[model samples]
Target: MKKILILMLMAASFAAHADSFVKGADVGWLPQMEATGYKFRNAQGKEEDCLQILKDLGINTIRLRTWVNPSDDSASGHNSKDETVAMAVRAQKMGMRVMLNFHYSDSWADPQQQRKPAAWANHDFPQLLKDVYSYTYDVMQAMKQAGVTPEWVQVGNETRTGMIYPEGHTDNWPQLAQLINQGYDAIKAVSPASKVVLHLDRGHDNKWFRTWFDNAKAHGARYDVIGLSYYPYWLDGRPDYTLSINDLAANMNDMAARYGKEVMVVEVGGEDSQPQNTYDMLMAVQQKVRAVPDHKGLGVIYWEPQGARSWSHYELSAWGADGRPTKAMEAFRAR
Candidate 1:
């Protein structure tokens, strides 16, 4: 009993030390933007490496998304495994931690659509399970070989309804659990220290989160982190952060207590046109996550903060029209 106690205490100490607030950004569109000659400037109005600009803004972590057999289109393609490994190595060399998001699709996978990759379209249920495990392990192993392991690996991106469509859909809870577990097991196999995240959309919807997580528990889904995407601009009736900030905080607290898991606002952003409002929103969100009991709140990440609206036509980016980051980026520095 004494030996077991010592081991447990050591584990707790390690976990405590490892629990640092993660300030991150998902710059999945960065590589494409750069290739197309989209340059980024620092506050000083001088051209700088985009990663350095992010680092200067106090970003300690970088999130990259990977797709399977993507097309070569500039808008929707080129997050292949090779590119992901290269990006991971680059971010690690810049003294930043990395988070890998697996979309498990050829394009974006989210609440509206979770289409299977074309190669996976005709696969049977059993084969799809193997595919998930094999593909996940392959990318993880590539990262390992490249000398940069991610701190967090997401099994799927914004999978509110579920991923891989009908086969792994929430309609069949058992199968969805199995698919998630396959990715979880594969990630652990390659990088045992890495935390596996199960991500979903709509961070402020407590009732939906509870029901989804309850079903996850009942069906035996495994994940170390409960990742959420909190986008006020996208919310139907509630278009302001103030309207949902309290609910987001409560949901974070409730998820940590109920599931015994760490929670992270893995994806968040405000309108670039409203820099001050976006900055305020970011500050508020950070405070709420930091307030989670026992340091269970991992962190918040801005999705595509550097993807300027002029280039990507995305409104939620933190970058200004002139290629410099907007005031919203300062919130990370404030901490």
Candidate 2:
């Protein structure tokens, strides 16, 4: 009888999670932007807390990236463990769900570069695995201490070619899977309720996702969510969302069906210069994600939508030069 009750409670928890559609944004740059006097304004051009402005725009989830032993560079650094915990606590205080992205490096970890942190650079393969687990566990423990339990946790950032390179590159699937599992296990150890995400870039490319995930599965990579980064403007030769929207929808559907896991556009954005087009693109992207059967399509998250171009000089942000959110952000209001 006790065992039956425990199973029912677990099922209820999962049902609650599935029913919540996440409208999120990765605002890892918020702290630095604010520190440098970057202001965020609502529709009326009135200064407001950035998170409050985002929450008003229907963002229920906030994603922040953490780097290992990062510098204090305004643009390239400052996502250290303590700062991340502080940010997570702030977001949670505002009644927002948190998603922590572990970059596993002292800097960016993307498809083009996945350098190991200087501290871990000298570690052997086995030590590297232990480093991954220990770092992940420590940060997660910090969040727990700060009263922030992230709803989702990414093992690595945009690891299309794999992460912690040299040893954990995609070419070395066995080692890569070990590194991934170390993070996964550590996350579960700290926050068992948090869904672990294995992220990749190019959400519309079905072939690449199939190849990568198939390898992960064969090598026993454990994760509950498949995270994708969709940037229409970044696609070569197909720089328009119209050209790839359908493809992204198809890929999301296929990922859910093939891997039997929840799918999320963990990162997405449009050109800030084209507000209307970006707004339309965002609406269409959300539509496609919601269209996925069985609610397997978790939701879409705009990457740094509030990282105004004037401050970050990032073209894909959804903020204007005047420190106000562009019309593109209104797409989230539909949620």
lDDT of 1 by residue, 1-335 (tens): 99999999999985764446889999888889989999899998899999999999999999999999988888789999999899999999999999999999999999899999999999999999999999999999999999998999999999889999999899999999999999999999999999999998999999999999999999999999999999999888777899999999999999999999999999999999999999999999999998999889989999999989899889999999888999999999975
Cα displacement (Å) at residue 176, model 2: 0.3
The whole-model lDDT of each prediction reads 0.94, 0.94
lDDT of 2 by residue, 183-255 (tens): 9999999899999999999999999999999999999999999999999999997878999999999999999
- The TM-score obtained by model 2 is 0.94
Off by over 4 Å in 2: 1-19
For model 1, the stretches where C-alpha displacement exceeds 4 angstroms are: 1-19
Pairs in steric clash, model 2: none
TM-score of each: 0.94, 0.94
Q: Please count the clashing residue pairs in each candidate, in the order shown.
A: 0, 0
